[model samples]
Target: MTEHLGTDGKNHLQRLASLRRPLAAIALCCSVAVSLQGCVEMMVGGAVMGSLAATDRRTFGAQTEDKTIVFKGESRVSKLIGEAGHVNVNSFNRKVLLTGEVRDEAMKAAVEREINAIENVASVVNELEIAGVSSFSSRSNDTLITGKVKAAFVDAKDLFANSIKVVTERGNVYLMGLVTQTEGARAAEVTRNVGGVQKVIKVFDYITEDELRQLSTTQDKQTAR
Candidate 1:
């Protein structure tokens, strides 16, 4: 039997093929980690986190603060919008991105206000749509799409996959990162072609090429320590 796909389906399959190797590598690593002894597993986990932290553009304090912001912001949002909407909070370097759905415009604005009021939140990008909450299946699909985008990023040689934060809301991909203009654009370009990505939104804090060079140098020095 022969099956012919439409243009969109063919493109989607091509994109998925490109991501297979990297995603498989990730799966292999996870499996290996699971087979390790507890002490070895802990050490492996610590080393992985340390490597990510070393390469991260944010300062250690900023990284810590971002995690804090996400936790507190999500908690606050949950309390305020209880049963009114579905919200996901992602904070990178104190800037928060709000994605998902709300009951109405007022709820959307209120969510933003609540997120903005969180301690150490520098700014908020409110991308909440005024609609009924998304279903579990839709959210699961978004998660799968997000994973595919991230795997595609990992497969791209020119981009630092860890540098870009990917968030998906109803098939819309939002990229948050501290990257140079060229890097941000390249990241978006790569993301736009990925399977299941309906749109790519760049929510980036841009730096100069010189600044990027400095960051790379700093990361190398930290990693060599």
Candidate 2:
């Protein structure tokens, strides 16, 4: 006989199912890479990375700079808070988003200040809550929710999944990317409907339809080469 699942168990299983599609796609990519001949490995690797860079709206230089900002920002925040609070730093196109928790408003402001000082950080969005550190179980749930939202984006064939970045803290979903106004709105609508999403916050840098068309053209040219 099959065992029955409680409401929580059912929800957990559903979340797992939501994540399976993207994970499976990744696995398939890995399998294909492994099956390729060693002679073509470098070519295939370059192609994959090129495809990803094309899909992202930021210039290649900006992408590298964003990585540097996140790494440095995280280190600075850690030194300041140091076991006293939780912090997550995400950088996109030189703009930083700060989430997680801090003990007081003072620390929250301090964290934002430090992030702003990081080289190449154009601006900072301070979403750090003034509360005690979140428990591990809560954080795990947040991770699951983030994955589900990403899967939902991938399932939405209308959107370019790589164009948007999803971040979850507690139950709130934060989306950051460079997208057209219509794309940003549609992404928020899709994310709002996902399970366990209490709220959806859009941090998108909007572009004109003409700008989007230009980006598409540029990406197509890069992909062709």
* The candidate that achieves the highest lDDT relative to the unseen native structure: 2
The regions of model 1 sitting more than 4 angstroms off are 1-36
Worst 10 residues of 2 by lDDT: 1-10
35 in model 1: Cα distance from truth in Å?
Answer: 14
Candidate 2 to truth, TM: 0.81
Clashes of each: 0, 0
TM-scores of all models? 0.82, 0.81
Query: What lDDT, from 0 to 1, does candidate 2 have?
Result: 0.93
Residue by residue across 1-225, what tens digits does model 2's lDDT show? 115878888888889999999999999998887877664988889889888889999988999999999999999999999999999999998989999999999999999999988888899999999999999999999999999999999999999999999999999999999999999999999999999999999998999999999999998998898
Per-residue accuracy of model 1 over 10-108 as CA lDDT, tens digit each = 888889988998999999999887777677978999999998887779988989999999999889889989998899999998889999998999888
The whole-model lDDT of each prediction reads 0.90, 0.93
